[model samples]
Target: MATLIGREIHLASRPTGWPTPDNFSLVEAPVPAVGPGQVLVRNRFLSVDPYMRGRMNDVKSYVPPFRVGEAMEGGAVGEVVDPGDSALSRGDLVLHQSGWREYAVLDAERTSALPPVPGLSPSVYLGALGMPGLTAYVGLLDIAGMQPGDQVFVSSAAGAVGSLAGQIARLRGASRVIGSAGTAAKVAYVRDLGFDAAFDYHDGPVSQALAQAAPDGIDVYFDNVGGDHLAAAISRLRRNGRAALCGAIAGYNAETPVPGPANLALVITKRLTLRGFIITDHRDRMPDFIKEMSGWLREGNVRFNETYVDGIEHAVDAFLGVFQGTNTGKMIVRLD
Candidate 1:
């Protein structure tokens, strides 16, 4: 049997507050040969995300947290190095749940072989054209019932999910689309992506900013960073306004939890509806999301940005950058 070699990182320890470089440990291993019904992948890219912070805690969650010393789990884009099943062949561009590694042996049924598009990068399967894209689509269309002419506001507007949410809102003919970002640069970035009004949440009170930007009130809130952002959005939502609680990054790294009254009383006063969902929670919507995103991408209407780190050794810093808003788009690590 042919022996293969690879580099890997495992969950060395869980973070108490913000994750540090020490929380992960790089390790090396000989890659296993592909077994029957499996395919070995040589990973090209891996994803680092804020949600992973939550997963590091051993507490109960929608998904289980990683165990200490275990390989940290996440999405990856790669190529098939050796095929052991008829479903996938060697040299296939693939996406898999391969984690923080340079190579992996996965069952053929567990990974997807990507269809080739001349200019599109395979990494898009991990970002705007992938889970983030699908999350925005499902949250807006199916969850929030974003009708044409509805005004939509998205938080964390320059990140992977928020960037696309703004563009989609515009494409849906929202009367006014607003977005909030952590810094002036990110605000400007979102505006460049076609937000009707964009604001740096750092500038002033978000509620006041919403008043100045919208004058009226927002109809839908695609919330990414929660805590004060959600509280502010609640104060400015119109009667019967809807909210898709997509993420709560504002509280992700806190040593103390950010309490969320978010004026729950307003639910009765405004007759509002709030829904929280994970992307994988709606797998049934994948076909529609892929069709729509592909069409917009082909039409050049929806654009995407990426911030890539060159290697897995810097993966910790890449992952930590999300909290400091160091990344302008999806933060990814090239593992080659």
Candidate 2:
């Protein structure tokens, strides 16, 4: 056997505002040897998400910031090349948090074996069957306390989490599902995903868009892009409405603080429940999420889209594309 040289994207510098290509560097290094209780994996798919932008900043948050000169981490699915002495076997597919790299050496316990889903690619574990999927499920079902026949609205509905959030609300018996996207094509895509209404936020004020989409007021709001969207949802939430404050991509790259919803007083007037959540804190719900989502996928009750950018070298571009709305669904990098 010969040595394996792998490439990984390192955070070269902290961005002051929106990150540029200069903020990342692709470096080649020897794949580390698997030691006891560890496994060597060759990553096949890497995820690029909006939340990762926040990790590039030097800030204290739910997750630690990505360190300069170090490989950034996110969700990845790979095949185990060496299982060392662990229960996992060579050639087994696994999911771990060692992304932004072509290969990873991980603790056996830290990596979860990915069972084969008939007719689905392992990359699905990186998207709909993975963290984003779980985030949508937990936020909408648990945090928001969504109920049947609820009129639900999801922002950034064309992105990975929001797309699934809107669909999950529909599948869970919401009477009406509305969404907002950044582009006309995305709005059409959201409508195709079963949203009763979807509008391009670029068309006009977000508040006006939400008004036309849900005239009677929304019973639940799954907020992925905050800022203006938050204010819009706050203004339209009915009494007792609940909001699952997921990611605020709108403020991820802000150099200074982004303003909060101006209509925040509506939270008081309507007695709405607005809660922010970190998906890591809801792992206990994964079992239920996987069980239900897997069934949905198998039965074709749920649909997902992924935009693949080939090669480890383009991973940073894929990451940046999320904020630019270059992807209609999950942005993924396919490593060779």
Candidate 3:
């Protein structure tokens, strides 16, 4: 087979605050050779997630910062084009962490072979059926210890993890699921996805909105947006309420440091259990998640939405779109 020229989006410069299109650059290079125990794959879809924004900053965090002038990486689903190992055959569908590119040559061990799900889009593996799904599952089930009959609230409820987290709570028998989003459309979308009450956070003070949405008080809070949302959840949490802290997108691009929720003191008064989690640290739940989430998708108990923009060249726009709230659910770049 002829060697392929691959294009990838690279971090041109680290942003001091909010990112712009100038922070990224597209470069062309030859696809690397398939080494021993390695495979060459052509990516079909690339995921643009909110967490990746943190990777762009030069900070000490859970994941290393993206190196300037180097290719940015995230989740991707692709087809193996050249097999150098028996584990992954040619044309096999695989999920890996080499996104922002059109082709990748990596160790076979680094890729997970995915089985096709009937009537489901393969790209869902990057969203609801993949990391985001697992993040929601572990955060709500393990971290928060959500129980049936709980009154649940989720922030950023129209985005990838938040969207699924709210639905998962309802599926697990939460008495009420309330969600907050940036726009009326997103608020409506989350309600359509089974949130018992959904409101536009921009409509008014988060605390007032949340209280109006869940007058009985929230038993569990799935936090995807920090800042005021966290404060709101804290004020409304029932005694001994549990909160699963996930992404803090509200402050991800803040130029100046943002203050913690002013109502943080309520945590002590309400006897709340607030825990933050990195989804990568909880791999033990993948099996259970796959089984349950797959069944949910198949039975139509769970649903996922993805916004697709074609071509690797549009990757930066897709990534920026996450921060802009341009996507209702997962934001993906489909390579042609």
Candidate 4:
């Protein structure tokens, strides 16, 4: 087995809201020889998520905060270049959690062997068929309890999780799918994704825009950008409407407090249910999601998109780009 050197990303400084280059550092380290029940991976793909922004702050969250000078953790997909465990073999593609790095050595128990996909890219295993896909599925179906003819709204509709949520809602018989995006390009991008309608949140009031799209009121809101988008959805939700709070990409880098508006009272008055959830909590449903998403992919019923940056060296910039709304879909880093 060959010894592969690993390069890891470290948290340099904490950002007030959205992150900048000052927030991250890159370090290279020696890769150790694997022992029994261990696998050395030459990572090919890694994920950059908005949720990581919350984790970067030294504050309380559902997940632990990132420690300074330590590796910033994220999901990665790579081939088993050297195998030391019986569960994995050389050249097998696997999904594991490492950081922004060229290679990683992980305990076999912490990794899973990914199934082969014919005529599909391995990088997507970190995207549509990966975390974002499962996040969309569980948040909408399991958490939101979606049903046919339900009107669904997704904030950051052009983003990694939001984009998929809208399509999944459509596939599951949503009467209408409305999305909110940051840019005109992203707005059009969501519409092209086959959403019933999409609006640019930059166009004045987000809630007012949502009201225009779903005049009858929304049955469910798959929230990605929190704050105003959330308040707006609450203002227009049907009685006892359900909301799946995913991420708050809107205020990730802000140094100031994000203020809530007058519409929040609607949550109590309308009896609207707004709940925040992390994808990790729903891992138990992964096998079923994989089975269903795979079928939809093969049948051409559902599609997923990704923005890739080549090489782990570019991972830091690629990761920071997501906060600037530079990516059109899920942002990933490719090592090969």
Candidate 5:
């Protein structure tokens, strides 16, 4: 019956290099009432991912840059508080792209109702069962053309997308799954998660580490961190190897142009296929991905981790933590 006051994190300024806390501001505002054909949602969780760093920059990319003084947006799961559409009811759980805020008012069509997954948390939709999951699914199977018994290598393997990508490869019958991470603990974690081999990139050069991990050469490379990792994968790929060009978090904060992989010539010499994709472009794959991934999660064939930072006020730190390698898995903010 009373107006709801909500808090949100806004992009205060674009960062020149690495983002700082000053780049974001948390402010309180009134939560708008649900209008005809609209729904009001109180967000319970917000996602902070490496891709967001690119969105903060004023550059032309697959997605538009975030506008200064506007609330940052990403994946979020919430409960509907006010429903103006006949299809949705109050108390229904939904997923939408109106995060970085405690409450959102949007057209009902923008929100997708989340069906209850027995024995799984609803917040999982913001991680393994959500965009990150879909990214891994489409990137590996469709883009990279993964085949059974292929040797697959994934960079940033302990993180959200890479973690799932490796497991998916294994579950789909990869003969060997190798992962590269930033720290020893992360390497161990991925190994326990079923990677046949895991290594800390900080311990040595990526090329050398990868070569040692996969002596015969890899058939599929799921690249998350570009730069040197790309070069390493290129050098070690067997003939006709395929690479799913995912995120390049290594260059996300670069003020200067980063160099292309010198060994890219291998793409031609080895006849490799390197392709980049935007997950939204493959929306038609969601039903299949959900069906398969849900089964995996239910059967414990796939596992995921999430680092939760409490409160909307700390959303900036959560976002920055992704680049700092502080989170071993998906970094999320608990806004409730």
Candidate 6:
């Protein structure tokens, strides 16, 4: 075979606040050779997620920060082109963590063979069927300890994770599910996803919106947006309410510390249980999540949407779009 070349996006500079186009650079390079026990893959899709925003900084966190000059990595799905002394065969579909690049060479063990799901693209593994889906599953079912007939509220309801969180609550027998989004269209989209109520946060105070949406108060809160939304949820949480604290995208790009919700005192008075979680810590649940979520997708009980931006050259644009709320569901970059 002729020599293969690939392009990857590198973090050119760490941004102080919100990242700009200048923070990333697309560079051409030769695809690395596959060593023994390794495999070469041609990535088909790349995921751009809200959590990645935090990785751009040099601060210490659950995961290491992305190096300034290295290819930024996330979720990706690809096909094996060369299986060098590995069990994987050519053309095998797999999921890995070498995104932001067109090709990857890694130990075979680093790639998980992807089973074909009829009527769904392999890219679904990066969104509704992948990390985001598992995040929702663990956060709602385990962290929040959601029970049947619980009235639920999810912030940033139209986001990749939040969207799934809301739908999962409804499918799991929540008596009522309310959501908050950033736009009128997103609010409507959330409602279409079967949320009992969804409101655009820009319409009025988030507190008032929550009060109106769940007049009887909520039994559970799936927190994707913090700040004001957290405060509002605290006030509206019924006594003994449970909250699964997921991503706080509302402050991911803040230059200064984002203030804590003013109604935190209410947590004590209302006997609320608020627990934050990192999805990676709950990988034990992946098997159960995949089995249940796959059935839901196949039965049409749950649905997912993707906004695609073609080409690796535009991966940065896709990443930036997440903060702009430009995607109704998962935002993906197509490299094929």
Query: Per-candidate RMSD vs. true structure?
Result: 1.3, 1.2, 1.1, 1.8, 1.2, 1.0
lDDT of 1 by residue, 1-336 (tens): 657768888889989888888899988889887678888888898988888888899988988898899788898898888887647778998877776888988888767779865467788889977888998998888889999999999998999999999899899889999998988889889999999999998898888898888888999999998888888889888999999999998888889867886588998999999999988889888998888899898888988988998898888888889888999889989866
Off by over 4 Å in 3: none
lDDT of 2 by residue, 40-140 (tens): 99999998888888788788878899999999999899899888989988899998889999999999987778899998878999889888999999999
Candidate 5: which pairs clash? none
User: Between the candidate structures 2 and 4, which one is better when assessed by lDDT?
Assistant: 2
Any idea how many clashes model 1 has?
A: 0
Off-target runs (Cα >4 Å) in candidate 1 are none
TM per candidate: 0.97, 0.97, 0.98, 0.94, 0.97, 0.98
Model 2 segments more than 4 A misplaced: none
Name the 10 consecutive residues with the lowest summed lDDT in model 6: 105-114
lDDT of 5 by residue, 198-284 (tens): 999999899999999999999999999999999999999999999999999999999899999987778888999999998989999
Candidate 6 — which pairs collide? none
Clashes of each: 0, 0, 0, 6, 0, 0
**Clash list (residue pairs), candidate 2:** none
- Those runs of model 4 whose alpha carbons end farther than 4 Å from true positions after fitting are 1-4
Q: Give all candidates' CA lDDT scores.
A: 0.87, 0.92, 0.92, 0.85, 0.92, 0.92
Segments of candidate 5 deviating more than 4 angstroms: none
